[model samples]
Target chain A: MQNEKMMLEIQQKVELIERAAQAGTGIVEIGSFVHPKAVPQMADTDEVARRIKRYPGVEYRVLVVNKKGLERAGAAGIMKAKLTVSASNSHSLSNLKRTPEEVIKGFGECADYAVAHGIELSGAISTAFGCPFEGMVPLEQVMKVVSCFREMGVKELSLSDTTGMANPRQVYDYCLGVREQFPDVTWNLHFHNTRGMGLANVLAGMMAGIKRYDASFAGLGGCPYAPGATGNIATEDLVHMCHEMGIETGCDLDQSIAIGRDVQKLIGDDRGSFILKAGKCSDVVCS
Target chain B: MQNEKMMLEIQQKVELIERAAQAGTGIVEIGSFVHPKAVPQMADTDEVARRIKRYPGVEYRVLVVNKKGLERAGAAGIMKAKLTVSASNSHSLSNLKRTPEEVIKGFGECADYAVAHGIELSGAISTAFGCPFEGMVPLEQVMKVVSCFREMGVKELSLSDTTGMANPRQVYDYCLGVREQFPDVTWNLHFHNTRGMGLANVLAGMMAGIKRYDASFAGLGGCPYAPGATGNIATEDLVHMCHEMGIETGCDLDQSIAIGRDVQKLIGDDRGSFILKAGKCSDVVCS
Candidate 1:
């Protein structure tokens, strides 16, 4: 019963995340707030918020889908939260089952939640780079998404290349456009390695002066919608890239790789990660 | 019969190469100078030289084993040749069956051939950063190996992080030492993605001012000695990195990926490459 798929326990999720945070997990994305009837896995955000383990330097963020989700996060003492507004009109409708107008108005409520509680908010524009259903995601459309979120007083925003369909050139062009528009607004890159060019796109972001990025340990968190899409770039792999470029990540590779293994084992899937299989090679000595 | 691996027929190879050049096969490695009995595939150095489909823009490089190998290259009318002296002494013994002393002495002989034929040589110190047989390859040994080739008037060199066992810190430190030792020498890098850090090492290489790199199409080439050791960095992947980062590669990723698929068909191995499976993810929209 424990290993059975679709038999996931919400309480168990709270416990696993608590242990994962204790075991040195970095950048754990706690939930994707949607309809209670839609994604049952994300149903226990309020309870999970109360049960989560908070590391000294870790950011324990909860996903807020609407005013109700934000209010629940606030009630659970989850101060900071992530809010998303999808670029694809169809994706927005299917995910939240709300029209784009409803979604933006809903985020207007999120801005109210932020002002009342001073909640640290990270606004994200999903499918900013591309969409599985719609095909091409325009920079203009993404900019409009961010522009609305910005007007609602949202500052730190992430452009999610959600479907693993973004190329590095598009990343460069799109990111450059965003950076030019935002100037100093903080943005994180959330790219899926589904097409294997995630790291390449990361490089594109770096060249565009992007410092903050979103990476899941062991490359976890695939799109349930896209058939073969994997999660964001592996954290260890990303940190390895930063470390190799003489950039400071302040994270341990060995520890990260270990957690990646743990997450893989917990998920009961052997289909993830490049760093764990290939240990750290940045310090070999040939004599 | 036509598809057999042992067939590097003179006329056939020349004709094939002529077409390959026309089809944009710019850097074709003609042959390695290992003993004819050992890597029998490289026995056609002379024939390759005699009937080369010489193209002014493209490079035709032969790998030299010893002084005798250089002589064969000269007679074959090759202009550019690569001389590799390993940093891993055990690999030196196993691959060349010679001690470091014998290899250096052979470099002296190879130099004589280069000077006699006006050949431009780029010395490669294999296992410069790591080795498979001997876990850690010493930096001094690599520099020493490089110095041996340098003493023979080989001013240009490429560092081979053989088997993808090198790390970025080591790459940075080692390249610093190499830069100090051979101040005016032109240097390139060779890396493998065995452990999934191929591009990380490339970032380190680019940081070290090493621009020219060696990558196989669809990540072709691996060691028969090391089990599960995959090929070098994929050319399309590398080109994508360069193009996205605003680095000029003078290569086309879409065309390269097409070539990769063609080569995969030719070799009958479909298990290589990530970008080929995932396709390019840059700004260029793909159908």
Candidate 2:
């Protein structure tokens, strides 16, 4: 029954990825190439990568923790791999069983492997804002990780609020600081709606001139440390807000909402999607 | 049976209001003095007003649609009454059975009654962002209502996103435009999380120099026009963000979260409170 459920989930993810590409998503993180025994949910990421029909002009990426995960990703014909580590030592020790420095040191081998295989590599710093076991991660700690990624030739970097403990002011200040310090690197923001500041943090990052953001369908995913927390900012909700503000995200709002609804049904519960529940702003009624 | 349930709800609300005041809430909108036939849930606002233990520093207020509602509020010994109208004519027609202009015109009598009875009156414009019956309400329409309120001797005003259709850019621009045009008016913002842009809009308003936000405990309030929608931004979530950003809101964050949890248990649902669900950012645990 577990294998059957995993197979069904893999097929559903493929369909969701196709629908997302059709809705004009520029990039999609298909899945993480993690140990199957540790995360059974992402056990079939290789199969998912092989089955997805790649859309032209859309980048497909996967999370890789080390050279082994990157090798698996390359074997699955994945072109882009994101190397991730928790910036805070407590989260790093808890989740990865190593300090942040040790994790980044391990990424050196992954970076070299990606370069040798002609695969694009980016860096992601998890718990860049705060950790469940530790309060706020210092800016110096995050900056140290960014500097390491830069030295490893990673140009695209993401600062992820793993526990949704980020405030707009903190986000804005951190984005501004990073951009000023690392002018050549592309910055992305990943925020969870844990404390309901996901969109607010996005707004702050945008004001600080950061563009790329990561969101999940129907607001799926949550922190294992912060139990009962909501997931990343909903993609449909984010697209709706951007379109309403005339920001031109190059996404189909209706299609995104449709995908959100489909994902909610697939999950057998309301996944905390705002646009999925409230409809688009243009969905006016004749009251 | 209905009366019994309502009486229980009334007692719960009194407890909630008293708890909120103890948690250092500056202003509390206790309830609406609308017709009981229209809104049966708020039928016992008079009783709620009479039963609550008032705090010395906190101001207790209620919503009043017209002179009749204002009179009822006065009879209940409520010193502060907020006269409300919809900025969008379509919403006004649907909810109030009149146009925005007509509603403001009628507020003249309300203003007169408040003055005669020594009741402090403020103005609130609902659907100031967008309306369910109309997509986007024009800024001029909102300005017209503000001008009327200024003429009616209402110095404090609140612009409410009734259906949560506001984007951050729109909020910032609108707030800037209104502050520039009406320099003397003290502005507050009321946003719903109908589309999950509530906190984002609040950030925009703050960036544009507007303070004084309205939030509900446990996020317990929804748009009747937009079914299956979330309510106002949770007060605990907002205070948590403010405290994290180093902005002092004079609120006790832990007490606010406790009240949110209590409200959720009373209502027998989660009610979409982030802090209530995830605990505070300070809630650290050993891994």
Candidate 3:
């Protein structure tokens, strides 16, 4: 799908992207409010968010770091925003430069701002299950943050393993704990394959009745602070699993690979995914 | 704990290994049936199976390629033996010179041999979720294989998405389908992270009620045919997840890492985990 001559390729890409967005998979995260200096590729997230047109069935979301990030995201036409607040204050200071309480306060600010402007907010707690800096994140601490967000009127939640440090057993118990305490919040999983347990954690979370997992294209772009991991679970990989098991993700692996391949071409060797190295699981050979 | 001589200090390692194995939440995969020429690392499996004294409760299993492999394995002195039959003929032919049917026939032979010898057999349908070359394996085909194995009087079953090509949905539905069709067979999971969805697939599978899983230390051994994916989920990473969620794995992370690190020193950098690069998630500095 690459055009070397650049002859109206922008229009073609736009069309391809339009179709992808319209395919309707519930929620598709496009970008996050990451520091440009830390991740230059993601620095274009604002522009990427702006260029993406919303279709009827798809919910476009972006990750925001702070109140200012929320403002920038809103201006970029982001209808749904997910904010990060780490349970491990150590991880929070390293990643977000704020303590968990300060992050909770920031979420309160974002909720007030979003309500005033008619924007929807979903609170994403990074390292909810475990922290890279903190060996084991106690269930009580995770409960503290979830309760704070619930009190702040942020009803939607996204629990993240941020570092891919969670296992299936922990995922089940952790998610069950959260779901029992905050029965109304809709939460998804945010896992990285840092330690190669991303999908296993997803299974653990799902067993606890949590649906909607987050992944990146070709397993690209994990947190800068969480060094050594490659990416979130690849988008095509997730879709392939769902399709095989009869879950309704509403995504096409071929189409998603096409999307990821395009981005990979742009990123060059910085992105890592074995599927791209080999091709899709459903790929065929012909003479 | 290495000494001045730079070899694995055995006594310390044994104590650590024993403590970790005693934890009970971990599974040790003891063998692989790939031809010795192809996967030489697996050649020492018998020695590995014999040298390691098993604790009272933890499960110890060895891998078998075919009936011939089972015979060699039988002399190795293991309580349990695992078997594999690839779903794709091309891969089977290339890797073992046998079609899926022939491999299953081998499984039947091995089953009889195991029964006669009073050895427990755990059947692993390798490349079960999808094949590296063939692509898009039919569920009916997988079901047929399962039924065949069941009829052959196999006791336990392991469904391997060896290529890391499986998704949560596929894992969930596939496990559900197997559970419904063969409620008596207790199933385990063997996932690769070629596409970064190994752990996610585990999550989906767990939701479907399968608990036991198989993984290597530090994500060892990538399938040469699956294009981009590597081998099983890392044992240390998997243990980290389990311990984090308060799920009891009979292994410890520090101990597992020591093993992974030791193996890495032996292999000297080709296959290992990135978490080893960035260090542990708990390495964070709290404010």
Give the top-scoring candidate (TM-score). 2
Q: Residue B107 lDDT in model 2? A: 89
Q: Candidate 3's C-alpha lDDT?
A: 0.69
TM-scores of all predicted structures: 0.81, 0.94, 0.73
Sorting all predicted structures by lDDT, with the top scorer first, yields 2, 1, 3
lDDT over C-alpha atoms for residue B138 of model 1: 74
- Compared with the true structure, what per-residue lDDT tens digits does model 3 show for residues A1-287? 11111222334444545656764457777656767665454566676666767688788777777777788788888878887788888888887678999878867778888888777888888888777677668889988998998887888888887776666777778889889888998888888766666656666676689988887666765666754434677776666656655667877777787877776665554354656665655563321
DockQ of each: 0.26, 0.64, 0.37
Mark the regions of model 2 whose C-alpha exceeds 4 Å error after superposition.
A1-10, A223-230, B1-11, B223-229, B284-287
Best by DockQ: 2
Per-residue lDDT tens digits of candidate 1, residues A1-287? 11125434667677656655665555566675556666666766677778776777677777777777777777887777888878888777766678666788867877887789867888888878777667778899999888888888788889998877776678878989999998868878898776556776787677778888888777777666544456778887877767655777767676777777776776787544777666665433233
- What range of 10 consecutive residues in model 1 chain A has the weakest lDDT sum? A1-10
lDDT per residue as tens, model 1, B71-169: 777777777888877787787786677877788786776677678789888888877777766776777888787777777888878888777777666
Error of 3 at B153 (Å): 5.1
> Model 3: how far is A11 from its true place, Å?
12
